[model samples]
Target: MLGKGIIKGMAETARNFLGSYVSAERLTTVQYPEQRIPQIEKARQFPFLVFDGDDPMKGLRCVACQICEKECPPKCIYIVKSKDKRVDYKGQMQLYPATFDIDLSVCMSCQICVEVCPFESIKMDTAYELSTTDRFGGLMVNKHQLAKSNEHYRHIHPTDAAASDAALAVEVAKAQAKAKADIEAKAKAAAEAKAKAAVITPVAPKPVAAT
Candidate 1:
């Protein structure tokens, strides 16, 4: 009975060794660069900017609010507001970023930037392959390199993208409704003004006839 514990450990090891060949759950090793496992939906690496349309510069959702830059734990994000203001996707006037940069070398991927962004322009990316040879410039990702399409966002984070789209739709509907109400109110005011003018001028003709 002295060697009984060792015998049981050996048996367990043999069982696992056999299970690795037979059981799908036990087969964990994958061929790197050839066969890759499906990426987890919630897994995230660095952050990327989300753009709406085909043109990354024109369609970028970032209004350069600087909230993300201010809130970044590592201070990896940098933004410069454009000299000329531009309209955003919601047709609201806002200042776009003239330059945006993220230092990947210092970035901790804490997702704080994405969380603090008010414009929903930034999101955590699933891409992890960021190996580089050049130490000076390769790690510094600029706006052009950071910008990614909304379609790509949907592809990577479908649930988050759908929720964002829904929220945007709600905002657009509210803006349209407010505009319609303003137009109706103006028309009503004009009609009232015209009616008042007609009513007040009518007595002049009657007075002339009486004379």
Candidate 2:
């Protein structure tokens, strides 16, 4: 019984070796690139900006709030708010980033930027193949390059993208409703003022005639 355990282990190993050629379940080797293992849904490697529509620059969800830039652990993100104002997709006047950059060489791929972002404009990208030959700026990504469509975000992270989209829709609806209420209140106030003016008689002319 002393050598029984060793015999069993050796027999198992031999069986596996022989079964690898004939049994589909026994084959474990993978040919990468051409036949890669499926990536997990939660797997993330880098950060990318999410845009709403076809134009990346005009449709970017970021208002250049600089929260992500300040919260970045590695200090890889850089941004500058635009001086010119523009109306966003939500019909609110907002400042876009004139310049945004992320140095991939220095990035730690921490999801803190994505978490601290208030606008839901930042997301972790699944791309990991970022090899480069240039030393100065090949890995330095700018706003134009970092911007990706919301459709792309849904493709990579369907659940998260759906939740964010729903939240944004709710916010937009709230803002629109507030704007409509304000307009109605102003119109009602103006109508009341006009009615009070019309109700007032020509008492001033009667007083002048008595003088």
Candidate 3:
């Protein structure tokens, strides 16, 4: 009975060994550089910054609040607030990161940065081809290198991207409605004041003449 189990294992191994030659699926190795497996949507390798529009720097959603950098488990993320402020996607003036760097060598790809980020600026990238000869320089990725378009995020993670977009749309709509209400309230108050002034009678002219 003991030897029967060993025999069964050997038989299975032999089957796989021989089947590899006849079946493409059974092949242990794939042709590198020319052929590759499709990347899974949830497969994450490293963290990358996501930008909305064509301009990577201008369209970046990160306000450099340092939430992600502070929360990073490995403490790989480093960020510096910009000296000048710029408008964000929500049209609110915000501080961008003048210096954003990630030491990929120390990065554990825990995705903690993505979770802590309020702006949805950072997300996990599926790319695993980070081999480098110049260990320090190559591994230390800057903001320019980490920045990717929102379209790319959609391409890689369609489901998450859709949800994120829907949430953002709702937020924007609420903000716009609030702004409109505030403007209308101000205008209405001004109009009411002007009408009240026009209706008031000028009785001071007779009194001044008596004086």
Candidate 4:
């Protein structure tokens, strides 16, 4: 019976060997590279940031919170902040970042930067075609090099880009509404305080009771 089992297994192997060469009738391996393979939706690849198309620089959604920098397993991101020099709505000068850099050589592409960004400023790119002659200088990408338009982002990851845009819009609307409500509440409280202060109390004459 043991010998019969071995013979049966060998017979199956022989059949498969013959089946592989059956050309049109065979279920066989696919040719790679020349014949492309479809990628799954959730596949993780090289990381890059998504930008808003309208205003390229301002669209950097990153508020320079530095949470990504601190959380990075590798210290790949380098950021330098300078005075914004732009006048705010209150006519006051604001301080903002002047320079932001990321060294791709050190980057592990862990997607942590993309994950932790509260502003949805950054996301992992699907592009895996990075090859260069020089490893040290050529690999490290600066802000200018790293920047990509929102249109470009949509082209690469349309579904994710759309979702991020929607989320950002909602956040902005909520912030604006909350700010407006706060301003109105403050104004109402001030008016009520003023009205209460303006109330005049009648002075009772001491001789009124005697009269």
Candidate 5:
């Protein structure tokens, strides 16, 4: 009986061994360089900011909100706010960001910054081919490195980028329209005040004329 158990175990082991080779025939193992797996639609890889191409300044969507910098766990985001010389809807100068930076080495790729950004300025990119001899030089991406035109953003993420562009266009148009309306309102108020002042009421003749 003891020898019978041993024989059955050996048979099971032999079956398993043969099964490995049998399954290998149907296996779909792709060789590196020869084959590639496509990424999923919602994949997030690296951090990047979107910029508007039509604007001569290549204006970035980021308003220097500092939300990304604050939310970043590694404190990798750095930004410098530049005083906007131009007037806004209220004829008041607005302050925007001048510089932005992100240290990729410190970034954990958690996408917190991207998620928390209200302006949709920052996002995660699909590019993961980052390899360099010098970590410091390669990892520390400045405004120049992080900046990409809206066209580029659309190219990388067509569906999402198109939506974002549409939203941004609406916002920009609204802001411009509000500015125009405010100016017109102010001008109209001034004109009304001038008209009221110009309309001098007729004064009654003095009592001496009756005498």
Candidate 6:
């Protein structure tokens, strides 16, 4: 059994090597700089922020919560909470990040940021062609650079993005419904208060004319 594992591994490698000649699908190795494999759907390489609408800043899903920055293993992510808040796509006001940056050089591509993000603001991207001469400056990505549209997320991870969209839709509906209910309750209360005042005051004018 000492050499059995090694032999099995060699056999598998040999089989794959021989199989590549006959089957195009079996050719797993791609010659870099020239030949490239089609990007797989679930292929994740780095973390990115997801935004909903066309404007990255306004549509940013992150509320500057800093949960991901705190949870990040390498501390590559940095966020600065804004002083002011703006209404989000879901009709909820949220604090946008004044400064959001990520040092890709330090990031290990662990995807922990994606896992811990509750706001669906962060997700993994499949882009791997990140070569740059200016390593330091180029690798330091800001919020504007890190922000990607929801459409890109959907294109990369259709299933998860679809689920996220569905959840957001449900939340938006619930918020709208709750707002409507609150308005109705306030209006009903005002009407009832007016009626009570009218009843309490009583008509004093009936006996005043000829008494």
Top lDDT prediction, candidate number: 1
User: Which pairs of residues collide in candidate 1?
Assistant: none
| Reference-based TM-score of each model | 0.80, 0.82, 0.84, 0.70, 0.73, 0.81
Local distance difference test, candidate 6: 0.89
lDDT of 2 by residue, 1-211 (tens): 7999999999999998888878887777787778888789888999999998789999999999999999998899999999998998789899999999999999998899999987899999998888889866898999998999999999999999999899889888988998888888888888888777667755434455557
**Given candidate 2, what's the lDDT at residue 162?**
93
Q: What is the C-alpha RMSD of each candidate to the true structure, in Å?
A: 4.4, 3.7, 3.3, 7.1, 6.1, 4.7
Model 6 Cα lDDT, one tens digit per residue, 1-211: 6999999999999998888887999866688889877887878888888998788888999999999999999999999999999998678788999999999899888988888887888999999997778988998999999999999999989998999899788888988999899899999999899888778767645556566
Question: CA shift at 48, candidate 1, in angstroms?
Answer: 1.1
Where is model 5 more than 4 Å wrong at Cα?
A: 1-29, 54-57, 83-96, 201-211
- Cα lDDT tens digits, model 5, 17-89, are 7886888764466775787777766677778887665552346667787989998998999989877654432
lDDT of each: 0.90, 0.90, 0.89, 0.70, 0.77, 0.89
Model 5: what TM-score?
Answer: 0.73
Clashing pairs for predicted structure model 6, backbone only? none
Give the local distance difference test score of model 5: 0.77
Model 2, residue 10: distance off in Å is 8.9
Worst 10 residues of 1 by lDDT: 202-211
Superposing every Cα of model 5 onto the true structure, what RMSD results? 6.1
What is the alpha-carbon lDDT for the whole of candidate 2?
0.90
Q: Which candidate is the best by TM-score?
A: 3
Instruction: Please identify which of the two predictions, 4 or 5, would achieve the higher TM-score against the true structure.
Output: 5
